[model samples]
Target chain A: MSDTTDLPAPSLDVEGWTCPAPLRDRPRVVMGHGGGGALSAELVQQIFAPSYGGEALSQMGDAAVLSLGGARLAFSTDSYVVRPLFFPGGSIGDLAVNGTVNDLAMSGARAAYLSCGFILEEGVELDTVTRVAEALGAAARTAGVEVATGDTKVVEAGHGDGIYLNTAGIGVVPAGVDLRPQRVVPGDVVIVSGAIGVHGVAIMSVREGLEFGVEIESDCAALGGLVEAMLAVTPDLHVLRDPTRGGLAASLNEIAAASGAGVVIRERDVPVPPAVANACAILGLDPMYIANEGKLVAFVPREHADAVLAAMRAHPLGTDAAIIGEAVDSHPGMLVARTGLGGTRVVDLPLGEQLPRIC
Target chain B: MSDTTDLPAPSLDVEGWTCPAPLRDRPRVVMGHGGGGALSAELVQQIFAPSYGGEALSQMGDAAVLSLGGARLAFSTDSYVVRPLFFPGGSIGDLAVNGTVNDLAMSGARAAYLSCGFILEEGVELDTVTRVAEALGAAARTAGVEVATGDTKVVEAGHGDGIYLNTAGIGVVPAGVDLRPQRVVPGDVVIVSGAIGVHGVAIMSVREGLEFGVEIESDCAALGGLVEAMLAVTPDLHVLRDPTRGGLAASLNEIAAASGAGVVIRERDVPVPPAVANACAILGLDPMYIANEGKLVAFVPREHADAVLAAMRAHPLGTDAAIIGEAVDSHPGMLVARTGLGGTRVVDLPLGEQLPRIC
Candidate 1:
């Protein structure tokens, strides 16, 4: 009974729980942390921890809760803000669902659920909201995911875009599989799933009023099934990335940066459909830096490359799979493309915004 | 040995999973579901659950996560776009943190974590972003929470106010304590932590060009500490709410709606600092509906009312505590104010946005 009074002597309990040191180290924010390196980890450790910390958050895994009963799950979130909501081939709605599902698929996950948050301008017509939401629902159905949990907020007519969406998705990744960026190796063959510049050209055509009588709509579609098909055929697939915001060049550069290796591609082997190459030539937008929504770049061991390509080609989602390049030990940290005329040029991360909000 | 070979295959293995059944029960976008009744429950069942099915999400609890852990945590989110970014006592920054933290604290959860999303105008100043971020940090530090995860995106200059903040926060709610709007009962004593209208008047003064030349500021601060202190003395505290946005009017009305009971207030017992009252009068704003930031209106059991009041008064954060109202069984779903002249008027919910975006 006497010990029961010891139950937390209030002030003593507070002192015991209070942070041992003053919080001077935890400055609320500094932009340096967004850089993909050391400072980011420190920021997550100090700031994100104490506030949102709990058992679930403590694991610090790429995708938490591994090896669960029966089903394996993968969850991820992404926010898209394409300046021109309506592009030649698609709208922001199509891009949002596709982008989210693709993220889940990259982890070898079958997308199952999505939650959408929409911020709308006060004067946005109910019809327009209806159209966008309809498109989003259709895209989710096509991607085989359900749109769950939605919230809507209206701002003064001028305070926001007609609409902006942030979507979070959850999916199931199978057992006996692991897909990570660090898996790329020296002899891995890189594959480009399809034409790249079409999506970018479609947006540019609409944005800058560049006319292409033959409409090349933005090629936006969820790639989960395609990825799953490829993974089922070859789980050894090393890296998976969809060049969306930043095109092929940017994706390659990011991979090179991550793997600390060099990448070189034969210009002729890469499958840039004639129409897209012609459009890139006319718009002066490099085909390599042009975005693609319905495509993915993968690296697999050479022994399994043809099987993966055959497997990709067999699937309706991946008809034009091409082995475009291979990871090399030389010319580290750079991307070089061999010309059809036997000339070579270096490709690096674009120094400026190539196409702002071309999601 | 094996039942494995003898077991029949499950129906949803792979091929069957590809075919989708056309779901027909849910509305495309109906207004009735938002009506807060039977339809809403159906919307939750047919549409929400099939997609978002999970233990916690399925609970359909008042606030999410019926049980996060033994460590009490409060989680809430709100968006602010008061026409003006800067007002007298506070700015969007002050309202953002205080509003979310107070909501978490309302549930006896000590405000702990905050996530901020900024939608900035394209041409908005770098300095403005820095200042707002700094103000947000200051407010969080003062509230004893951390700014955890954040996202930033710039829209076309005209697409947004100079700044708009959407804050989602999480806090800890202790064991052996429970507080909800439904906890209000007849004979319960209502307590107003301080003079109302500081925040509301501050915004109105700036927005309407009223010369309260005396420079009145908003009483915006995290109320978790004061609430903890008060709750320490009276764990039976009934209802706790920060009368923001819709002001005391909205807050009380919400409690009435939640409790299915009536509320009556003595006008004389309600304290409004002269400046705020004058500002409200000059601006044609009702003090009852004018928001207060640093202030909160609470209800406590009659037996422990004095202890709660003394505890509140002892905290510098809550110096002007007062008994302003009580719960009543008559006139369910009604809020009435006893006029200084002994008359009564229904305190109705705001028909529409007040001080639009006044947070």
Candidate 2:
């Protein structure tokens, strides 16, 4: 009846879907799956981990800690697709560099070399690519890493938006430093490097044409130096996370799940820049759930918390560092906030990030 | 005149163009630039190397050889944008794995780990994505490498064509087995692992709806094991190359340019399958310019040539291997082909590949 003989048969066996079949629900990829939230985590754990089974994957860290020829190395990769290639304070180039560098730094590793892959659309200007390259080179200099090997591929117009960058970094983790979420304990103090929600707001302003009188620059910078400074004070730092997509709320929830520990933070003590707060108010956005680029959250032993804070404050990138929370023994695998009005509320990880591709 | 008061100034300083300014006349990217030809080389040497300057980049090879903690490592990356997603015998996933693994293998390195970065379109089917992941996992297992770390990004609809995959690999180069184009000498013999033009013809057949009675499978297999097989016979292999994108003609030209020597290949001796020859005749395509994935071209000393060829022919993947040419001292930095008609023709690198996205 439908000329079925002319049509081809289906390729895949849809009846046998098992990995994350029930949890994901959607048969098509949604924007939120790339938002770095519960969907992102589920996609990673259920789909990717099961497909690519390896011992190193069992340990969930910012970068894979690999033993190669009697040396410890950290390898991590991140893709940058932030719209409006150039934002207020940084462009996609610097974001690509800082993002991968921050990932390696989260493992207390000093990034040494990086590999960059570029996917460009046809008709993209050569001058724009050159400018992006210049920005990338400058950022690599600041991060103390070399862009060693790279690849470039182009798609026909309409298949891409200007360019997308993927940077994979290799770094050496110092011998004494052993950092992971599993090391978090009940007596650990929670510290944030600086104010949250600046990077996301900066991108939103330009893309949405919502200027807030004063220009909001992205807090995009390499945190390798700041991380090294903290490690100098103590190599026993328990956990380090960069609140990029889904912001600090997602980071806290991830740590709680990974470490199987309870986390409680004081809302008033969390630093939110005045401009960011105003932007969030206008956007009806919660600052805690917005993304950050250069900031980091650290969980350290209570005994070394004061010293770590002092060391972080001494660094230029961490001048606004503040201790806002602590790991708790009760209510394991949960995160809560002490509200400004003397109330407590659960801060659960969203099914998906409020904003997508903030990085 | 045009209500331009609210518009901001352009960001990049186009007036300050320096690297290969006059040579690369085009200000916009064309498909040919990514065709693995002279334009691609010019883009990398002029634009990327100058921006990301380092001593390591001065040595151009399939991969960058780095010394870290007294261990020699080979690092390389490749991006796949092949259309149709799936072909006769291989998909983009296997191409992604085998391509990077081959790059490391060309450097006489055994690939150990890989990092995959996927850029997915917003509405891409999850089933398609799952199938790709499964193919990738299967390929990694076959290559004896692990997909250690990965990143995924989703773009809005109309901004992407299904998906693009980028893989960066790390491998350990065995001691005393140095491989580089500069090491090629006048007396070296040129040996190709198998027949040429199968991969390009396979992809073209599907894209153009050409039927040769029988489906031509893509020769997309990992070459790390093949390289190891050759190394077992002799560690003195001078140079190795996989003729992907630009084919054997491009590879010969590049080797000549890098070694500053002349190459002479016999047309009759170069193995071309009958089906590929027929397809080329129908399409008016040069078999020499077509791409290959699994085949490799090796330059070995005259004394060790027989042993290496024997080893290659003994392997299942290289049963059709043959010695097609030899390096010559005349006409340095040029490639000459001896035709079946008993005449010689100059083989220069094309401005771009005859077929784009054949990989």
Candidate 3:
């Protein structure tokens, strides 16, 4: 008689039988699956998109713009799992509010209400919870949105970290405003709201106990007002992105791939703070792949580039706005940066983030 | 001079300095804070309500009803942290979709779109994630709602359980259909759809490894269709509640307190399946306090109760629907149950759930 028990269980041989187009080589979820990079996109496209089987989710915008009851609505959700709940300039509470708000703003919508879901760990101090709650309330007020509804759940002490918050927001899209990657044209001008890599460096400084001479605080703020200011210049803006998890490079790559266009930026023109650059050099990380919370990358019509930049500069949140790139007819679905030494280099989408939990 | 190093830090004196009305005696969050009972209500009223500072949240309904761009919208959110991601008859995926759908239905709205947020623990099997996603997609299709947008984040292996899902739904409330606690009045009949205690019992069976003669599956389902049938009988439903987390007892106590009315139910009229009853009896748990995911407790006008009951009976989800109680003018803000032995007893809101992570 054959020894059946000695053989591998049928379920254990999942790789041998199951189709692996979506999951590819990995049979287990890794940090990269949530890092908003190539793996993240693959997971969404192969698994989530096919499973959902809906046009709305397939749009893959920062927020889904939908028409309901004759109203144009923007809906989005984001979960905050950043370690060290309290950072230099903000906390998870602020990100919980601002992150979703910025997502709606990316679709040219004015966020109106937010739904907060909190998962708390058992035995976490009440004062700690209160502090986080207070910060969230303050951030919502500052963003001009209401925390209208909420749900709370708790897990056993070891089963959860101190707190993980998920915020889903709803907003109203203006009558004539439409922002999507497909709107990009070859002559479009690309503008960035401010310096990159500050938020990521600030987080690393705290988590790794590495400090430069100057204090680097997170650039965490709601960008609804900044977007409104840009829209005031002209609602004909092509696209907008918050450049979060996978940073500027991921945003550019996604836009290029979605729109089937080429994105070119001048490396000398891309603003990077001295402290952030020093920190990245020491850590052997690229600033292009570091995350940012309170910044936006916009593709606008060439005719309105200067006017939009001027308006963004007038807004308090966008004082550092700069036009650093333009869409190109060549190299479709690719991002290229012109080095300071006058050489062109492809800036590919990151395979994973340099640091996890930098959001 | 006495050594000052032994003195306690001022921050440690949270009990002595901070106003204690909201937090009351507890210095840290307990499992009860997420139990959907007295502690949950206290957390909302004292902490979340004040922090939010808005009237929409004060309604304390299953969903927040709001007017956006001349369209009446109902928005609600819930986080599912049930242990053992998969259970009999349902999984967290099913609950993630149906729970939010039912919340909107309670407000007389037809859910249109849902936002799903997933916090996955790193190293979880890809097949497991795929199964959960497939279940979520199937449930959304069955509920006739679209999963429009989603966000995913991963925590380190030990920092989380297998998976935690949060779903937020948006729906449009039909015109002239206004449901709220204040609309409830004396002589209003309370009706319960199907049986209670099945879901909780099923979870306990797996967790405790206790086997009954018959398998008791969770009563988890989407109630939008059953609710639509009920509304055809009368557009004016005083209030509706899904008996989840804290079960029928908690739902009744909340309605009684919110509407400032007395609730009286005949214990024999409350439906409890034999298998569930047997499991609960062996486990020393009360059927009234056990959770039911696929059931609802609704208060309707007595004049329309018979028609509503008929409508409910014709639907697949409400086959066992029955009128179990009525609101009374005397003993406001209390729930009283008449036992089978011809005695009345006060059914107070549970301090916490009889079982944690029941939903």
The candidate that wins on TM-score is 3
Query: lDDT for every model?
Result: 0.66, 0.85, 0.87
DockQ of each: 0.06, 0.43, 0.50
Judging by lDDT, tell me the better candidate of 1 and 3: 3
The TM-score measured for candidate 2 stands at: 0.94
Give one clash count per candidate, in the order shown: 13, 0, 0
Q: Candidate 1: where are CA atoms >4 Å away? A: A1-90, A94-118, A134-159, A166-198, A208-211, A222-242, A265-275, A293-323, B1-83, B86-116, B137-151, B167-194, B223-242, B293-327
Ranking by lDDT: 3, 2, 1
Estimate, for each residue in B160-191, the C-alpha lDDT of model 2 and write its tens digit.
78888999898888999899989999999999
Give one digit per residue, the lDDT tens place, for model 3 in A280-334. Answer: 8887777888899999999999999999999999999888899999999999999
True contacts kept of 2: 0.58
The lDDT leader among the candidates is: 3
lDDT: worst 10-residue window of model 3 chain B:
B9-18
Clashing pairs in 2: none
iRMSD value for model 2: 3.8
Instruction: Give the chain A TM-score for each candidate.
Output: 0.80, 0.93, 0.94
Candidate 2: segments with Cα more than 4 A from true spot: A1-24, B1-23
**Ranking of candidates on TM-score, top first:** 3, 2, 1
State the lDDT of candidate 1 residue by residue for A23-124, as single tens digits: 233222222222222223343455445433344334332223222223455555545567578876678888878987886677788776665656666545
lDDT tens readout by residue for model 2, A1-359 = 24552232221111121122344456667666677776677778778788875887667677888887666888888888889999999999999999999999999998888988888877787888888988999999998999888888877767888988999988889988888989999989999999998999899899989987688999999999999999999899998999998789989999999899999999999999888889988877788888899999999999999999999999999999999999999899999999999999988776565666677
What docking grade does candidate 1 earn? incorrect
Residue A229 displacement (Å), model 1: 6.7
